[model samples]
Target chain A: MNSTFANVVARRDLLRELTLADLRSQSQVSRLGWLWWVVDPLVMMLIYWVVVAGIFGRGERYAPYPVFILCAMLPWKHFTSSLNAASGVLRASESLIKSIAFPTMALPITQVLARFWHHLFGLLVLFATSWIAGLPLGLALVQLPLLLVFQLVLVLGLSLLVACFGALIRDLKGFLGHVMRVGFYLSPTLYGIDLVREQSANLGGWMADWLPRLFLLNPFAVLIGGYRDVFFFNRMVEPEMWALLTVQSFGALWLGYRVYLHFDRRVIKFL
Target chain B: MSDAPKIAREKNAPVIEARGLGIWFNLQSRRRVSIKSILLGSGLRSDQKVLWALRDVNFEVADGSVLGVIGPNGAGKSTLCLALSGILTPDEGDVAVRGKVSTLLSLGAGFNRDLSGRDNILVNGAYLGMRRDEIQSRMEEIVAFSELGDFIDQPVRFYSSGMRARLSFSIASSLEPEILILDEVLSVGDQAFQRKSRERMQQMMARSRAIVLVSHAMPFLRELCTHCLWLERGHVRGFGEAQEMLDAYEAELAPE
Candidate 1:
């Protein structure tokens, strides 16, 4: 573990360069250029807005549903895209893995950072759209950075785990998309957490109470909830939520690191 | 090109030592298993076969010497190079190296083609364990060695394959690692550039305490190496002085 940290610290610049290179390689071929990075999420947001607000008449259910969805959707997009990219990144970097012998963790970390770059751009668009929608921008925005740090840790850990397992399980490359799809519905991406609580109250059972707890157990729900609290509500994350989010992120990271360490040497053979 | 007192040749002080080093790959059985077969409790037994890429390899290379590995395709030359450099762990036994190791196993690897040749240098150099400032300081030398000139700033995708090869080789050579493992990357660039690379390698070898080269070009190995190992089907066919091993390997491959 000490050696692993030393290796990462030693190649910090290389990691940065690899992350930048990922972004450049992705955006280089497109005619829209770097705009595509932000445009992708923007388009997805518009599609959701059209379906949920325009067709389903969900616009009236929540005042400015676009803002509500954007806050959660953008972060969810970051998480899903990062995981998706990270999972297959090892197989995608078949040539690089065969050629160079750097830390394997660097590959997943690079994926996380690359998606984070695009997510950061998408986030700027989100903030602008939120401001236009009359969502108050205030001291709560300061909590945005804290939330980002926690989310980054969560994403990095999951990415490592997925990347490692995805290397071993050939079916996982395709299956992960399905997993993320299920995760999207399970998470509070398009809907409100309060909606779940309200529905659960109407059901009136132990099972109903457990359903909301199940949602909270998901790190994505906790993070999306935290992001909404800061971006829309302009409030500090509750102390208990903060503790839970911290524990979840770091716990995932520790587990991911252990898994990576177990599989790092074996990854080459799998690749 | 930094002048430091070279370690004098000392008997029994090996820079790299491999004791019964072996590496194997588990080839996944191609027989598809369906849910029906699993439910019937058939095809549940493991069908994985182990392909030993390298087996029972043992060698000790001292400072101020080059160990040239010569082998035909699938002879585990690259596997040995990778294990020696700490890239691939051996499935059995162990390999120990006493100094910083750098490998240039394949060309244009880990390079983002969209990035300029100069940027690739920084990334590759960092991969080889040099710090950013260290890579930056050697940028001019790497560029000069690669001779890409104006193409250095252009995206590497446009460069010729030889040009890409030159860039990768130059970066690894510039690092001047104590234990350098180069796997068949020396045959790069044009004839004139190849000559320059050879000269550059000679200079790098002068500085590096130990070097391992895996190449199909036997004469190149004969000229550069003090000792050689010839591999065939993951087994060492010959290991001795360069001239003796080369002659024996050549004899073995001769007609009839």
Candidate 2:
């Protein structure tokens, strides 16, 4: 038990170092450097805003659609970017994995942490935009950190699951690209849960009763809704929903870690 | 030199022990076997050949001794090193290791090419189990040992192969781990640096650290090693005192 605790501490130190290395290399390689972190989400927001608000003339329900979309978009980018980087991480770090005796799980965790750094910058942009758009700051904002932590837990779990299979499957990276593209529309990034409920009610049957619940089960649906409530709608996420999300996020993490360990030895051989 | 072997073997406690160790590799799937191949049943082809890279190997390393592994190319010396260092999991038997291990498997194996030498040192040091504060404290010593000077701050991609060898060796050595594993790492750099490294290794040995070295340089092995392990075609050909093993190895080479 003592050695195990020491092992955990050592792994944590290695994770910190690798994440810093990843972030440093990323910033140093590009000409614009750290500016890209802020710019990336803003650019993504502009494109989505133009399409949903400008071209389609949808988003009439959510005024100041930019802030509404930015809140969820930032977290969504964090999710997708982390998974994308993790999907090929084992194969990409072949030399390091082969040479060092450290835990392999650090590879995927580093991706999540590095991307989270960028996500933090996206949050800064969100706060500035909220201030400029004259959105009210209230006690609802107190729940922001809790929401972000839960989202991080969710992303870490998914990243580990992807990294484990992605190392062996080779096709997971491309497959995940498609899945995330579709998932983006399915989540409440561009619209609100109100839109989903109203659309579901139009169906007017058991489909109406089940479709919204099914949507909420996606985990991101709950998280994005929470962000919207805190940042745009000025309300707390429903207690039952927050409780469910807490369970779901940690459950995914537990399952992901189990799956990763199951394939951990095989992964190095495959690589 | 006469009493060196006896002095090296004076310590009786084994720091490393392996029994019936084996590592198997799928010859047909040297690269990653794709999921598409498995789905299509091509991965199930009976033509796949399994290669036991190391089979039924047993060895032990006592504290304060150097065990030199010598073999021809593809004789599984490096495989044994990997297993010992805990990088590769054994397929059949198990290896037991005590105390901290630091491995220099290959030059620049974990160094990020885009990062500066100083940054790579911190990163590699962490991989070798050093904490950030520990690495920071030893920063000056590692840099000075590498002799990278102004080049330490430049991106490692700009470094010459010799410079990388110097930096990696310096960092690994600075860790001063309980067990040090090296795989042909001392072959690079200029002759002066090689001699300096050899002297540094002697200093480490004098301090009673265990070492696992793989090299083709017979004279260096004979001079530094107390025990020698000879691997031939994934099996142990010889294991005993360093002098006896080297003599037998040289005899075999002369006939060929």
Candidate 3:
């Protein structure tokens, strides 16, 4: 990995300019402007709580199911929404990319950052809900600051590949969303991880063991499970599992960044 | 802080260099993208027919000089400028530039239409490789030079096309670029802005850096350029001192 790559990309300020510009334009569109970033997502969470909470024997599973789902869904929402925003970034910025010298992955990087700003608001709401529900808090939750770093690297690295592909093939936008949706259900979010192990001696058990451990490459799962361990149980994230997760997250990151850099120089000419 | 020592730049090396420079459109060999296919959403492939905007062209511009490029409608002038700016990669051959470049390919080629004039100024400042502090220091000068009135606060799309041109040109020329590229963009404004454009070019040229002026106006080329290259249908027919090339090119343009 090039040590200076990220810093150089950040210095270009194209991403910064575009982000500030996006924020400014967004603010002018409505009087309630920037606040909509938070209010919109919280409203979606509320709707899901009202609709889905009542349907499944969702209450039987655990404490304050609404907040639990929100905690799990918060980072997931960011991951998915970022994919949607990033996929079209290159195609839309034909002017900037074609005419200037800068990192192409800055497109996906901006998408991740803008959505991260939105996700941070959702996280605050999660903390508030946890407090209202009277859930226990401990040092386990502090892992968030560290874990989110890995999540960001993973997201930035992986989404860049998809953004490039999306530029070439327009349908990649819908394809990525559909794929993430499937990953949502397949993941242990909202549901327990044991479902797969329950069918041990078969493919289900095999998947359960590998999915959470190996696929910790997915920072969201580690984040969600870490949330459950910290708030729901007041326990520390298993040290061994954390190690596995860290390696996978950064490993995916290293490879993805290479792919992004490999194609960056060609983007201007192609566009 | 380090006091920089002055060093002489090499003499033999050209300030601008292009060798056998050729750029061609992909001409994706497919019968798609025609209006019939586009309306029906059926033709997803590209057409295959090579269109050479520039071919086997060769030129060298020395340090502290002015080079004018003149050609007819399809003479690859803008393509050459784009290559110089590193915006387009040549399919064959190479281009190397010694110093920073600020290209005025068109009035609004790089500006965001939806942004306000002030916002576009900041955007252009950063696009021209100015640091934040650098742009902030000069922000007022840019605004005043634009003479945009209260319209500067409104989205650029709300302004007349001429207003957008003024903002882009002012912000771009406000910075002293080592290599300046002017792409026939001066004809937009009224006579007053044209005079200002010429004045700005003269001031920039006075700094003793190389520049490439591409225009169809042979008289202006003759008047301003220290050297000139006359292009005819993607070929360079004359390249030498400005007056001589212009004389040769004009003779060719005469009825025959």
DockQ of 3: 0.28
The sequence of per-residue lDDT tens digits that candidate 2 reaches over residues B1-256 is: 0001111322454787778899988777576656678789876688778998999999988878899998899999988988888877788876776667777776677888889999999899887778889999999999998888999999999999999999988987786667788888465579988888878866665664688999998998998899999999899999999999999999989866
Worst 10 residues of 1 chain B by lDDT: B1-10
lDDT tens string, model 2, A170-256? 688887888999999999878888888999999999878899998989999999988888989888779988998999899998888
TM-score of each: 0.91, 0.92, 0.85
Error of 1 at B12 (Å): 6.0
Clashing pairs in 2: none
lDDT per residue for candidate 1 within A218-237, as digits (tens), equals: 99889989888887787888
lDDT (Cα atoms) of all candidates against the true structure: 0.81, 0.84, 0.71
Per-residue alpha-carbon lDDT of model 1 for B1-256, expressed as tens digits? 1111123435666887777889997765233333445457763667568789999988878778899998789999988877776777778877778777777777778888888888788788766667778888999998998888899999988988988888888887787678788888466789998898888877877888998988878778888899998898888887889899998888888898
Which pairs of residues have clashing backbones in candidate 1?
A: none
- Tens digits of per-residue lDDT, candidate 3, B1-256, equal 0011112346667778778888876555212133345457664544456778788888889988889998788888877887787666667876777777777665665566667888888877776667778888998999988888888888887987787778877887887878888777475477888788778867987874798998878777777899987776777777889998888878878998
- Structural RMSD, model 2: 4.5
Which one wins on TM-score? 2
What is the per-residue lDDT of model 3 for residues A1-271, given as tens digits with 9 covering 90 to 100? Answer: 0113754464567668766776677667778977877776678667767666776556555657766777677778878888888778887877665555444565677778878777787878778877888887777788778767767776776777677666655466766777898899877676654443454426664675775554455556666777677666668888866886678678767776777666565444445
Question: Which candidate has the highest lDDT of all?
Answer: 2
Backbone collision count in every prediction?
A: 0, 0, 7
Window of ten residues with lowest summed lDDT in model 2 chain A:
A1-10
